[model samples]
Target: MSFADQADRTLEILALTPGWHRLRDLRPDCDDETVAAIVLEAANFAEGVLAPLNPVGDRLGARVVEGRVKTPQGFADAFRQYAEAGWLGMDVPEKFGGQAVPLTLHAACAPLFERGCVALMMAAGSTRAAAHLLAEVADQDTANEWVPKLATGEWAATICISEPEAGSDVGRLRTRAEQRDGEWVVTGQKIWISFGDHDMTSRIGHCLLARTNDQPGTRGISLFLVPNEIDGRSNGVSVDRIEEKMGLHGSPTCAMRFDGARGILLGKEGRGLPHLFTMIELMRLLTGCQGLGLASAAADVAEDYARERRQGGRPDQPPVPISSHPDVARQLHELRSTTEILRAAILELATTMDIARLEPQSGLDDFTGWMLPLIKNFGAETGFNVAGAAIQVLGGVGYTRDWPLEQYLRDARIMTIYEGTTGMQALDFLTRRLWRDEGRGLAIFLQKARDEIDAYATEHPGASEAALAALDEFERLSAGMISMRDDDPDGALYRADAYMRAAWSVVSVWMALRLSETNAVAGLAAQFAFHSARCA
Candidate 1:
């Protein structure tokens, strides 16, 4: 935590603010107070133990021997420490010896681990995500038998969908699954399987997808839980190779080859595409934090550097810290402001998921169905920008291994590419979320923003002109979007991302507004709103 420059004000802003556990408050059905405590404690441990290891991990990288991957020197020890703390089961069901913590709290703290080292975060990430999807789709016996071990970290898990040719076009996946001896045999080559193999866990299950000859396109595929180890044998699976990655080196990405690996059917046959979509949803939400968490770390690092480092000199004048430099301050400010918004956005969506889980019929559930990817895409992309700014603030040193920015950059690069790439996200936002069913979801989100503006305007007539203009422009642009839907799809969707930006800004600021209503920070809320409005 060397500080060439740092921002006391920025730190004060982050530290003094109280984070609302919105889900617990809004939805009583999904109580997670205990879960929050567990998540925060683990987050603190991760920050203390794992964050310190990241620079070393990046320098050391994961070793690939033969076809097996070994994490950086200390990662094994740290992973043991992590599991010893019972961090793995936080999100799994209580029946499976998991905490079954509310999604919001888990979402809240998941970022801290990623911030420590995103590569390593990806290791268990897909497991939990895929496992949760299994809980949704698999039979009770399957969940009972596998979830406990998976949650306890006795087994690792992964999602297998992408191949050499089938990425964004999930429908094009050519992996084949055929029934044999009352079980399915899977044969496919999957790339980018994070933590595809590790010596730390004995059992590895892959939530795999392949063609089943029932239907063509995505419907032809079904999800199967393929165990990598059975009776100490290969289980018809092989690690073809590990990816030589740019960052998150502590976590190895593998290309896996399945030679008729025996797997249990997950969920229903031919429902794999939709069932697997749930896993994608979960991963997208979690991966949203990946980029944001890493960017937040970069911001924290830059802020610390700025506050303490004295660069420019004056003969008679006292040396000013780098934070005193206007450009540095601006970078820190942008990073903090946008990060604040990003955190707010993610938290909002997290709470939405929690509420959905609690009250299945609550509008939040349907809203989350569409909004999850939107928030994920928004958070990560902004996070990339924030991490880049943090790097710029660090200058040449940022590009070197001597500092964390290069690792941050390498980590950020994958965020835009993985889970779902930025392009897919944009397409999802415009076509699936925004215009789907004539844009009901987007309209709901917009109404929420409008309600905030209306409430704030009524309560505080002195609301800044900036806020008002931003609100007005938001309304205008939204109208433009609606008007163009019938006449110009491209023009309309071109601004879909812009609309997303505006919506994120307004909603984030509104959160600060609504939150400050109880926190006695009306001025800060107004400032957040002003910054949000600047997106227009």
Candidate 2:
């Protein structure tokens, strides 16, 4: 299925969710036809405008000329068109110049755009997340001042957390902010900042974290909105240099310096890390969309190549399509199944997120928390792995610049590293979501899985068996890990990766059942079963 068709199916499923009525109450015009139209338009724009730029950006990249970072040709213009189309504010609140649509719709549209060009679409997530963050945390006046611009994409934003000394250890960041002469002055340097300096927008807002007091660790850190341009002049924020990355050259990964840059404090002092979680959570979710986009693209390319390329056959007969081979056919099936399952899982999480927002008492928030780490990590892995698999399917041509698979592979490499690494996600899942939260999320997920299995048991009895077994194994592993946490924290940590994989297997199974019910993708449940058995 095409991305648009997948998005349409995702919406249809989301509409069937329990609290979907609440979403309609929130947005009266959010009917199936309207939303699907929006998604279709977005998919068209992404394919026609954004996908073509993927290769251009990869080749030309963004460059610094005369101390200013200029994005590759057509980037600035494309961004302008993107902004004018109001995609930047698709999920932002209407009061802040956004459409205020359900996040489910946003999530549906995201993968389509990401599949078009992840490097360029990188600017969209942070900007939209920043708008939401400001709406939630910032004062009315501050939010009023910045959120609209971000929502409109007249300005772009970046989450500035990492520094030379801090990557995942955000508390180790040394950037300092102090009030002087009735204004906050930020002085420090941040590295590995995406789109830190870009020509796509005249102004770039750094949603920054800075040490504000003598308190230790994260307690001293505070969030600030530091703009690159203040009152149409420089704000003492300068780009030191842009990193030469292995991929995503289209998006600039910048090292930035702030020498007494004026900043406006966001939220409360000494609460930067917690407040930034608002943006971090959204970015993490979007990271999953990034992976889905790449995986979908790779799957499409490989499947197309397999159907057209003729190779092995009996010596007496003419050559047949490689897809006729059992081995290649198996690879294609696994790739499609995994990609589609991940898409369903990601979209389900997004729908749950919407429900959580509309009806917090539904207990779906914990479910979202439980699933975020899984989707974020696995989503990225699927993209990179699918791209590599596509390269293998295409033989030598895929490895060369002629095919987009190599570029997809290179661009996808960073997804696992950024937006919190896979290790960090696994630890978060094992430690906080499972252990500290007392397995509330796990309990919810288990119940949901049971309900799904029961609902489909009669029709898909054979399918339910594998999923049920996987579900049981996940519960056993999670319980054991939680039990071991106090006695051997290191042991628990060591098993975190295994625990995470088991959880993914469980969710994939559940999604496979859901997909099977739709009959949208044939044999996905069995494909998942085959893979689960292999892993077991």
Task: State which candidate has the highest lDDT.
Answer: 2
Segments in model 1 whose C-alpha atoms lie over 4 Å from true places: 1-22, 25-40, 313-315, 458-472, 482-486, 490-496, 511-536
lDDT of 1 at 400: 78
Between which residue pairs do clashes occur in model 2?
none
lDDT of 1 by residue, 1-536 (tens): 31111122222223322223445466454444444445557566767777888888777777667767777777767766766676767777877787777676677677777777676677668777766876778899988888877777777788887899998798898889998878889888999888888776788899888889857688787889999978888898888887888777777788999998999988888888788887888888987778767777888878887887788868688888989878777678767766665666676677667766766776655567667766777677766787789878887777777887777877778776887776677667667665664667666666655565566665554443345555666666666676777889888767666666666666656555544443333445566556555655
Q: Which 10-residue span in candidate 2 carries the lowest summed lDDT?
A: 517-526
Top TM-score hit: 2
Candidate 2 has an lDDT of: 0.87
Error of 2 at 510 (Å): 0.4
- Range of the 10 consecutive residues with the lowest summed lDDT in candidate 1: 2-11
